[model samples]
Target: MNEKERAPIEDTHFGAVTVRQDGQDRIAVDGEAIPRVTLERDPAAETDPHIAIGTRDPAHLTMRVDGVEVGLLPAKGRFSRHSYRVDVEYDGAAYRFVPDSIPSSRLTRDGRHLGDFSSDGDETVLAEWREDGEIRPADAAIGYTLASAFGTGAQPMWMMIVDGVSNAIP
Candidate 1:
């Protein structure tokens, strides 16, 4: 496994919502698969012609774009893959990797809106964390990965290396 590699997208879950990669995003709305489009997917599909959207998760759904990924409907319980293309410059040297999609905002422990992670896209690299914003520092720590590009062995993806320090929830 490369140092930059992340966990397979299927194993990870968003917020309290859970969904599987490669499978359609069908959530049990009264025990029925309610079909819906993810917001992140909607924008990417409109902006980039290469985006391919999956089913909506009753919790949250993830969108795949030109190998990039982003979480849609995170509040519904999902993680974004790479909604935005970000360039990260780390340690006086620039290392640009795919940005893993995470919940941008969520209710805090005290019930307040707040950022999910802290990132400069130039300093700290991305990593995965629980919905509560706790870092496990485990090797198998859940993260994200990109689907292999056509004819390219490179599996482009990003993982949470340093959890973002978000703004205080009010």
Candidate 2:
């Protein structure tokens, strides 16, 4: 959708953090309405949509914090279209995001617990972080955008088959 036509899809608070996702698939945090991450739909994307964090390239899916860009390179699970797990590495840290259920996923960094990304089966989605200080709000926001926007969890085999058949017919 165009920028003017974009509407808010989610606006909710989890503890002190506020997360909002707009109709354009841009997600913002806290009181500032500026999008920190955006899910950019690209027809050329190999499997899933591309992500833009800050002013970085959407194709590379880099994360920018305080004007410094951190490269988020996919480490595993990139080939299988049905795979639910995605592993990435950046700044010497290994991050893993795997589905806990259809509407939620768990994020970990270097084998340490980080937080969760969940939806209420509606427009509202949340990213709640652990209290261990290992994860920041920006990190949680990135994780949430990745899991929610990328369709990170596996779809049922029957549903996949149905989708494939339907797409082929059309």
Candidate 3:
């Protein structure tokens, strides 16, 4: 019998929630050292799970996967310029903890990345991050307030476009 060779896809697990490769739209569930892939919103079987980060006077934030709202900040106005973290576990792996605000930016109609996050343990490996490009005025609808703080000259607001195709880790 011949063996089949399969490529490794990036995945992470934090407690109970698991984020598939590249933090794409879908996540997996781990059970007894086994992994079960979940179906995320599709853009041609190509899903892009996203995280968004921003600051507000009241500190209201929400996280969604592929347009499907997954988590919400019930306690609005709880934080002020502070970073919130949530680590999810899936597929027997632990993905870094991230805020809903981070992915929201990617899921937006015109979302972009602001920066990347280093792995919790490895410091050298890039766990996850946002795009490093400038988001257009149209894309800055909700991020405008935060963007203003970064300046509008050349950098404006640090952003990134998640390339799910890469299948990298958080």
TM-score of each: 0.18, 0.51, 0.20
Q: CA lDDT, every prediction?
A: 0.23, 0.50, 0.26
Better of 1 and 2 by TM-score: 2
What's the CA error at residue 126 for candidate 3, in Å? 12
By TM-score, rank the candidates, best first: 2, 3, 1
lDDT of 1 by residue, 1-113 (tens): 11342332222322222112221221110001212112222222222122212322213333332223333231111233332322222123221223223422111222222
Candidate 1 at residue 144, lDDT?
A: 20
Pairs that collide in candidate 2 are none
Better of 1 and 3 by TM-score: 3
TM-score (C-alpha) between model 2 and the true structure: 0.51
Best by lDDT: 2
Per-residue C-alpha lDDT of model 2 across residues 85-148, encoded as one tens digit per residue: 6565545677777766545677888888787776532224566667775555455555755654
> Model 1: how far is 151 from its true place, Å?
12
Could you tally the backbone clashes for each prediction? 19, 0, 38
Name the runs in model 2 displaced over 4 angstroms. 1-35, 38-67, 73-82, 120-123, 131-133, 155-170
Error of 1 at 8 (Å): 11
What's the distance in Å from true for residue 22, model 2?
7.2
* Candidate 3 weakest lDDT stretch, 10 residues: 147-156
Error of 3 at 133 (Å): 42
